[model samples]
Target: MLQRSPKDDTGDFLFHFSSIKIYNEHTLVAAPMGSGVYVRHKEGDWEGLRQGMPEDVHVNRLIIQTGKLFACTNKGLFEFDMICELWRDTGLVIGCYQLREAGGQLWAATPYGLWSRTGTGWHKIAYSHVRVYDFLFYPEFIILALEFGIAVYDRLVGVWMEFPFNEAVTGLAVFEGHILGVTENGTLLHGDKQGGFEQIRFPHLFLFSIVTKGSEVYACSDRGLFRISCIRDQITLISVRLGCPVTDIDCNADNLYMATLFQGIQRLEL
Candidate 1:
C-alpha cells in the first residue's frame, strides 16, 4: 500500500491491522492500520472502500453483514455500500471498539456501550462504566470480555451474568462448540457452549489479534502468527519476516490474509 502523507510521524510502520471481516459472495474486507478498508473480491484485491474516511480518526473495526461493510473509528461508525459503490450515511455510529456479525445483525463493542446494527439504526443493547475490550457471540448469548473478566448475556432469559476474572481480557474468538479468550498475559480460555471458561495452553507472548474458523485458531501477537487447534490445546508457529508488529490474521476458503504494522495485506494460498 502506497501511503500519501503519513499519519504518525515517528511510527516507522504507519499501519496496523484494525479489523477483518468476511462478506457475501466470498468478498473479504480488511481494515489495516494506515488509511482504509482493503476489499478483496474473489482472488483480487482493491482498496476502494477507504475513500472519504475521517482524516483525524483511524479505523478500529470492520464488519460486513447483509451485503454492507462498516468501519468503526474514533469519529464514529461509517457504513459502506457495495451495490451503490459508496458509503451510506445511515447515521450508525460507535466509538473505538471491535465488531462482529451474528444472526441477522451486527454487534459492536464500543468503549462506552454495546451497540447493535440492523437496517433500521444503531441501538444500545448494553452499556458499562468501564470499556468493553472485546466480545463473542453465540446462538444463545453474547460474551463481553472487559477489563475485569467476562460478562455473559443470555438472549433467551433476558438476564446478564458476569464472572469477574479480575484481569483484562484482550481477545475473543470461537471454534466448534468452544469459546477461546486470550488474556493480557496471553493466557487462553476454552469454554463449553453451555458454561464458562477454563484456562488452556495459550502462549505466553503479548497478543493483539485472534480469529478462528473450523478446526483452526489463529492469533497475532508481538512474536508472530500462532496457529492453535480448535480447542487451543496444541499450538504451531508461523514466523513473519515483516518488520512491524503483527496486526491481525484471518483466513477464507482459498487464502489466509495477514496485516502487519504497515505491511498492508499479505496473502498466502490456503
Candidate 2:
C-alpha cells in the first residue's frame, strides 16, 4: 500500500491534479494543472514526463490509444512521445474537456463540438451547437451528455438523435444495460430513446464523473465517491464518502486512482 503523504514529496510537484487514466494494469498517468504530467511507470515509481510541455499547462483529460499516451488540454490534442519523454501537439486547436477511444479513432469533447481523429486529421462529427460535457460509446451508438441534454449518434443509420432534459448533464456512462447520465445537481438519469429520461433519486451532490467496474458503478462529486448499483431498474447507493471533490477516477484490477481538485492523486487498494 502507498502512503497518503510521503516526506520526500514536495508541494510544487504535486499540483492540483484533475484527471487520472490507467493505460494498463500497472501503468497510469495523472493530469495536473501546472505540473504537466506525472506517469507511474508499471509498479516501480512515478516520474515526471513533461519535458517539452508548458510549465503552466492544464491537462483536462488523458487517454491511451494504440499503445500511446494522449492528452486533451487547453492547448489542443497532444500525444506523449515515449521515446523522448515529451508531448507533441496533434495540430487540433481545441480547448477539450474529455477524451475517448472508439472505432479505431480518438473522440474529443470540446466546447466547440465533438471532434474525431481517425488517422492524422480531426473531423467534427455532430452536435455543433450543444456544449458537450462527457461521452460514452456502445456497440450501436455513441452517447454524448451535453450541457442541457443527451445526444445519441446512431452508427448504423449515420444520424444523430436527441433526448432533451432540462437539467444540465455532467457525466455519461453505460450501466446496467441502459444509458445512464448524471446531472449537475447529482440526479441519476436513465434515458429511453422513445420515452425520454427519468430521474433517479440518488443524491443531491454536484457529480462530475462516472466510471464502471464489472457490474458496479462509481460516481464522483463534490461530496465524495459513491458506489451505485442498479437492479431491476432501481438504482441504489452501495458505498460512499471517500476523499474530497473527486474530479476523475481510473482503476485496474488491483488498484484505483482518484484525482482531486486539491489533493493531487490518491491511490486506493481495490
Best by lDDT: 2
What's the CA error at residue 193 for candidate 1, in Å?
7.0
lDDT of 1 by residue, 6-108 (tens): 4336553255566666677477677766566666676563544756566656777665556567777766777876666766554655575677777777777
Off by over 4 Å in 1: 1-30, 38-50, 83-85, 118-120, 192-204, 230-244
Which runs in model 2 stand beyond 4 Å of their true positions?
Answer: 4-10, 42-46, 156-159, 192-194, 240-243
> Cα deviation of 78 in candidate 1 (Å)?
1.1
Model 2 lDDT tens row, 1-270: 343335237654656777788875667788776567887766555677777676577787787777888887777778888778788887777677778778777888888778888675888877867678788887888888888888888889988887777877767877656778988777788765464778875555667778776676888877678787765657666555465888778777777788887766777877
lDDT of 2 at 57: 73
- In angstroms, the error of model 2 at 182 is 2.2
* Cα lDDT, model 2, residue 129: 77
Summing lDDT over every window of 10 consecutive residues in candidate 2, give the lowest-scoring window.
1-10
Name the lDDT of candidate 1. 0.67
lDDT of each: 0.67, 0.75
